[model samples]
Target chain A: MDALTGAWQWLTTAANWAGDKGVWHRLAEHVQISAVCLVLSCLIALPVALWLGHIGKGGALAVNLSNIGRAVPTFAVLVLLTLGPLGSQGEWPTVIALVLFAIPPLLTNAYLGIREADRDAVEAARGMGMSGPQLLLRVELPLAYPLLMTGLRSAAVQIVATATLAAMAGGGGLGRVITAGFGNYDTAQVVAGAVLVAALALAVEGVMVAVDRLCDPMRGRRRAARIGRGPGERRGARDDDAVAIGGAA
Target chain B: MSVPWSLTAAAWPSGQVPADPGGPWLPQAAAPGGADCLVANDWICGAYLRTRSHELLAATVQHLGITAASVALGLLIAFPLALLARRRRAVAGAVLGLTTVLYTIPSLAMFALLTPVFGVSVAVVITGLVLYSLTILVRNILAGLDAVPAEVREAARGMGYGPARMLFGVELPLALPAVVAGIRIATVSTVAMTTIGSVVGFGGLGNLIASGLQGFFKAEVLTASVLCVLLAVAADLLLMAVQRMLTPWTRPRAGSRSGGRRTRATKAVA
Candidate 1:
């Protein structure tokens, strides 16, 4: 209780919100790094994943390859980049490490989503004389939207969490607050920094969920019913579960 | 070259370098062994490994132990929660929601939140890891149970099997693959996450990685990171073997690619 009070007091302190090292500055830095990494990751991964998924060739290999990438701890990647030649570059090491860390989920989920899009619908669209790009954009992308959003949500949250390591490498971020607290043995400040990070992560997750709902192409199309009945729906649910499991890790 | 050199110097000023210039923290300084790669900060110095074998072994063991214990405890806890959720649909949403929220919490923040309660100890690390594993384990177990064919359960019930026997003998056997899949993911992710534990001085290989990073000890960082990755892969493969042995009936046909696909999909995450 006292610790909570202390943390609250630390959070409310006016001085803590001022200067270059203050809470607001660190929060902005954390959000900026996370957004940049998320965008870069999506740009780098989604096209390749979607393309391979559309071609229906080499996607499994790509997915499997990315799965192996997941086993490499993000912390290790960040530290390795920092110690290597890139360590001297301003924020490049952090950006590159985070982008690498965020790629696997985006790649795997997007590829799986595209591959798992309603095949019969795709066939019908093709039968109606739709071109390759037309079939993909009109039929596949909408169907794949839910899983793509799942991947984005997972990646976004992960980048926000992992960006704290920036402080460890002498970069600016909310993690700096925690590290500084540790240096000073100020438990209150450490707790306060942690609270801010947790709040930011949750906020990111909430925003992603909102975006997923708002941007779903299948909106107002009785998606619930489509997701409820038929053999196709059952398989879709199972695949979504598998993808959720992927994101959970 | 000059650009990078100046940046490096700016990052580390003179006062930060301790009197013993060649100490673990100052990788570029002159050392007791003037000609050694360890003093020169090579990424794979055999001498460092040869000298620090015991320390390396200890960290590896600690890492392995923490992972095993966390997953095991998580399984024990998740089983009851999964069973409860399966039996009573009312609380299912709450259970899943709580775990998912817990999963989203950054690991560093997770540790900080628990520190007040568990203090600076391995228990704090273990508890956080156990919570993290719940989202995977509970969902997989539930999915595995749900995947059991309805007729199979009906047949078991017709054969005088009670709920307990049906669960233990019939349903669980059928659910083994998914359960094992969950365990594999949890184990591998746990191995990766265990490195984060180093922030609190309890991370197995993480401690070495952290210390190595501070000192810019290339060999230690690279070696520990590689070992951590290897450990994750090895654990995953071992569990895959276990899953296969436990479910021989589900083995893929000679030319079928389904088995490979399922494995890859289940291992979608770390």
Candidate 2:
């Protein structure tokens, strides 16, 4: 109980510190880094994903490359780039690193979403004399929008979280508060920063959920119906559908 | 011919053209100067190898061991929670929402948060890594379980299978492919994030790269970066192989368009 009280007290103090003007500046810097990185990653990845999805070639290679990008740690990449001729030691290097980190999900999800578009719908469009780009713009992209939005949402959250590493490199953000809290053994400050980040993430997720619902209005109805059904009934319905599909085929 | 040679040389002018068109160029002449440093740094070369090889090996082992342990724990916790959350849409949404938020917390901040209480050791590092893996792993597992055909579970129940038995025999097996795919994603992510352990002063290859950058040691930085990329590639390949091994039951049989169609349909639904 005493330890819990102490922790609470520490948290309060930290929150106070976080509210300081200097800390807010740092937080703003971090948000800027995350936003820039997210935009840059989307710009780089979306076009490539769209192109790959459209062509339906080099997808495996593009996905594998993006996976490799994810595997490479942001810190290590930042450190390497900062030590090289491009040796930017500040926010730019961190931005570049976060951009690399953010690319895979955006690229993969977008590519997968488009590639997984309803083939029959696409065929129907083509049969009506739609050109390749025309079919993509008029038919495929609209249907793929919800999944694409999910990818963007994922990318946004990831970049925001990752942007904090910039603090280690002396780039500013909410991470500086966390890092400083650690250095000073200020538990409250650490907790405050962590809580803020968590809250921010939740806010972003809520926004995304809303966006997802907006993109797919039918999802809500289907989800609600699934929920209202008893487990056994739900299972029966799914099984029946599968059996029907199998029989038809 | 002798008289012609003198005339050709005189006409060309020494500054305007080289005596031989195919002669080694100025840059070639400067190559030896570059090689001199490398030749003189032989002892440093050996020293570099001795120090780096030991550190690299130690870091690699520690990283792999920690990552594997965390991933295993993450899988164990996530799978059951996912299963329980399957029918409870509200609970699942909340869990998914929480995990997604958790997933987005900067690893560095999480480590920093842990360090004050845990004080910068292996325990804190492992805890952070495990937490990071849980979000994605749980989401994937739940999604996989949710994806199992309703008829399969109904069929199992009709066969007098209890909930536990049905889950183990029917739902889990069917969901294995998606679960493994999630695990693959989690494993690769955990491997990468383990590099952040460097901030706590626990040595990983990241530490080498960090120090190399701080001290302007180009060779060390290059070596660390190259090794990290190699490790990531190797980890991805290993996880892919493991995914294939574990989900052999889910593997497509010969000439079955069914497998492709099912995958496409599920993707559309998602």
- Model 1 residue B98 lDDT? 90
Instruction: Please identify model 1 stretches exceeding 4 Å from their true place.
Output: A222-228, A231-236, A239-249, B1-35, B253-270
Worst 10 contiguous positions by lDDT, candidate 2 chain A: A240-249
- Candidate 2 residue lDDT tens string, B47-145: 343334545565566667667777888888887778767868788778776665566666776776676567556666678877777776776676567
Q: In candidate 2, what are the lDDT values of residues A67-181, reduced to their tens digit? A: 6756777777766666555655445677777787777777876786678777998999999999999988887787566557767777777776766666655556777766677
Tell me the alpha-carbon RMSD of every candidate: 8.0, 15.8
TM-score of chain A of 1: 0.93
lDDT per residue (tens digit) for residues A59-162 in model 1: 66766755676687877888898999988988998899778777877887788888988789899999999999998899998888887888888888778877
In angstroms, give how far residue A20 of model 1 lies from its true place: 1.5
Q: In model 2, which regions exceed 4 Å deviation?
A: A1-21, A88-90, A127-133, A204-249, B1-47, B87-90, B146-160, B246-270
- The CA lDDT at A188 in model 1 is 90
